[model samples]
Target: MSTPVRSSPLALTVLALLHYRPLHPYGVQRLIKEWGKEQVVNVGQRASLYRTIDRLSAAGLIAVRQTERGSQYPERTVYELTAAGRDTARAWVREMLAVPKREFPEFPAALSNLLLLPREEMVEVLGERAEALDRELAGLDASLRAEGERGLPRVTMLEAEYLRAVTAAEAAWVRSVVDDLRTGRLTWTEEALRAFGDAGT
Candidate 1:
């Protein structure tokens, strides 16, 4: 039986890249960056990428195509997707696109604990976040325009476009919430908070 590969964003990314052609770990990492996939997948740790590759190979999702050696470095193993891997890649793409899974990202988790911080400090920090989001939107806008000018297919930049849309929406919400907080429209007293907690009980 084929060993079951653990599903993760990185694993899916590796499988998708391998679907194209055989690639060594270094080649995979390089292509991820060159193709701007780092926006969706985190490949900051080379060790993590290597570990994922080992697991994929162990699971028979990918197989060793060949090993190439360069004079400057150690032997590099090229890997290609297996039949199961190709099918898994296709399934992963379909599921990820179709289903909106409940992912616990840091921002929402932090937001849940927002009341722990001082109200004024919350406003200040959130204001900073709004500014950062604005800057991000501007940069993404430029990238989108540049890609469009270069006649890059929209399919290729869908993630970037999604990111820009999300950033814009978040910025607007942050600004509105900050204004509410500053204007005393969304205020709470210690008594009110304690009562709210007691009500939850």
Candidate 2:
């Protein structure tokens, strides 16, 4: 089989937006921000957005519908999704939702090196993180409630739901670990540490 047209998250995002209608890059950027996709799509710089659009065009996923020009401002190129782009967008969404990619999240990386610090220090730091997760979960809950009041169905807000669920799960696990540490249910004695490996380099 021929190689698949690999799409970056930004490229797919642009394709998905263009699937709605032909729009200039500025419109794409605006809709991304307005739709709260900024959390997932990192279009921090306009150059990045332009670059993704260029890539999508080169990949035959998007095409320039027209360029609007006026003496009042610079010319703007309007883009729309091609048939291939529409199919790609639908396929990308399905793959992303169904496949749990191996993401290199910092929490797991930090957990792997957690023994570098004293158990007490680790507990203290994790307690702080737990607090932060609580605040984040509360904010998400409020946002979900507000969106529901505005008639946004849960299906449309599944991303937020996933985030909330993940955060809640992490918080619960952290609390359990904290309780175990405090009650001495989970710990390593000095002898056990030395037996397993050196406590110091």
**The candidate that achieves the highest lDDT relative to the unseen native structure:** 1
* lDDT for each residue of candidate 1 in 1-201, tens digit (9 for 90 to 100): 667876888999999988888999999999998787888899999999999999988889999999998899999999999998998888988988899899888999999999989999999999999999999999899988988888989999999999999999999999999999999999778998899899998
Q: Residue 153 of model 1: what lDDT?
A: 95
TM-score against native, each model: 0.94, 0.86
Instruction: Report model 1's TM-score to 2 decimal places.
Output: 0.94
What is candidate 2's lDDT per residue for 79-100, written digit by digit as tens? 9898988999999988987987
Each prediction's total of clashing residue pairs, residues at least 3 apart in sequence or on different chains, is: 0, 0
Top model number, TM-score? 1
